[model samples]
Target: MLCGCVGLVWLYEGDVEVAVYLIWLALVFDFLDGFVARLLRVHSPMGKELDSLADLITFGVLPSFILYKMLQQQEVDAWVPYLAFLVAVFSAIRLAKFNIDENQQTVFIGLPTPANAIFISSLIFVDGSYPSLLSYPVLLIITILFSYLLVSPMELFALKFKDFGWKGNEVRFSFILFSALSLLFFLHLALPMIVMMYILLSFFVKIISTT
Candidate 1:
């Protein structure tokens, strides 16, 4: 809740970097809330529902707000703002599916809400350096692509810790290692690239495992 408020302030201030960091902070809180819940053996149906609702606000609504800000700056067509709502709707669907799906106990069936949020936030975070890339047409296409990923069937996103010593976990471990290195080197600017890479890497891993 505090993180969400901070993000809202950053949004109003037009500080995309701070807003992105606040989104990341929300992600940390999201993780800790679940961790503490489990450690305290206080997990309940209401807690689960509450977490999802919090996520909807932090990840879904906040990202859309950031994207809307970006589009406003670009003087994008008035209709472009509607695409931001697509993210929120798709995120709601993703969270609802996660709640009911037995297969998502250990892994996600589609892109997670936090990832989607980070992806959108990163676009604003690096907007100046990637001016040509952040144009309305490109952003529109990306918005559509990410919305598709939110419900994409072939994606198998992981939510649990991979066993470090396990043979089959090598890809997961390597991906995490590379992601950490990317963050270390590029800070927030690397977020979107690393996330896209992770999605592609997961696809190949799934293909190999299935074979």
Candidate 2:
């Protein structure tokens, strides 16, 4: 979470690249916190609450701030930039839901905050490469779309692996392979695409199972 705060500082400093890097650092800490807790078998209610709070800052608010900064750069209506806060608002609800919902043990009911954060934060690169592409309208649309996705009741597969067997882990392994190749081939541009691919693949798997 402190990394997230520092990311805000960097965002204010107009060093968006640094801000994004700090977000990635926060993601590392987020993963380690859960890993360490599971390793020690020390799960507490307070720890869970703290994790949600920290996630709110690091994944929720930080990514919104990035969007806010991006929207501010565009010559949009004054109220447009405020829409970015929708991500933070929905993220709070998402985290709250996750805390109380038992069904999310192995699958997410909606988009994960960290995944959404990564997708949003990576938009900086998109905006950098194609300034016109991230115009006010486009950014606003993305914000609204993802805000709804946060609580949209759509199921997304979690990347956990209890056993690395090919039968049950086909989707996970395929996604990981595609992600690796994507990063290798597309570099930073693959970040948002990877998230999109995750969503699409989840839906594809869902359809397959139903049929």
Candidate 3:
């Protein structure tokens, strides 16, 4: 949470790239906290709530701050930057749903907050390679679309490694392999593409299992 606060400060001060990096660092810590807790068999309700709170700031608020800054940097209409907060609102809804939704054990019923954050940040990491993204109209559309995606009913596979065997871990393994290739080929742009690929691969897995 402290790191996220600092990142938010950096974002407002016009140090966007550093802010994005800090958010990513926060992600590493977030993952480790959960991992270490599970490794030690210490799952508590308080821990879960704390995780959500940290995520709300690191993944939810920080990403929106980045988007708001990017939009502002682009010199778009005044109203456009505020639309970025929609991401945080939807992320909160998604996190609350996850806490109560027993159905989402190994798979999520919408885009995960961290993935959405990475997707939004990765576009800016490209350093203005995609000029269309800077357009106010385009940013608004993306903001709304991502907000909806955060609460969508689509099943997205979680990247957790449940087993070492390939039989049940095929999707996770394939995703990692392809993600590596995507980064090799597309560089920073691959981060967003990998999120899109995650959705497509989930559908493919579902179809193949049914057939």
Q: What digit string (tens of lDDT, one per residue) describes model 3 on residues 1-211? A: 8878999888878888888888788889988987898789899888888888888898899999888877786776688788899999999999999888999888999888988888888878564687765577777777899999999998888877767899988889888999999999988889888988887888787787789
Displacement of residue 176 (Cα, Å) in model 2 is 0.4
- Model 1 regions lying over 4 Å from their true place: none
Pick by lDDT: which candidate is best? 2
TM-score of 1: 0.91
After best superposition, candidate 3 residue 114: deviation in angstroms?
0.6
Of the two candidates 1 and 3, the one with more favorable TM-score, higher being better, is 3
- Candidate 1 per-residue lDDT over residues 1-211, each given as its tens digit: 5676778888888777787788898989888987787679888788888888888888988888887777777776787777778888888998888888888766678899998888998886578677877888887887788888988886665746645575766667787888899999998788998889878987987898789
Give the C-alpha miss distance for residue 202 in model 2, angstroms. 1.0
Assess every candidate by TM-score.
Answer: 0.91, 0.97, 0.92
Question: All models: lDDT?
Answer: 0.81, 0.92, 0.85
Q: How close is each model in CA RMSD to the real structure?
A: 1.8, 1.1, 1.7
Give the Å error, residue 70, model 2: 0.8
* Candidate 2 C-alpha lDDT tens digits along 1-211: 8988998998888899999999889889999988898789889899988998999998999999999988888888888899999999999999999999989988899999999999999998988888888878899999999999999898999988888799999999999999999999988889999999999999888888889
Best candidate per TM-score, number? 2
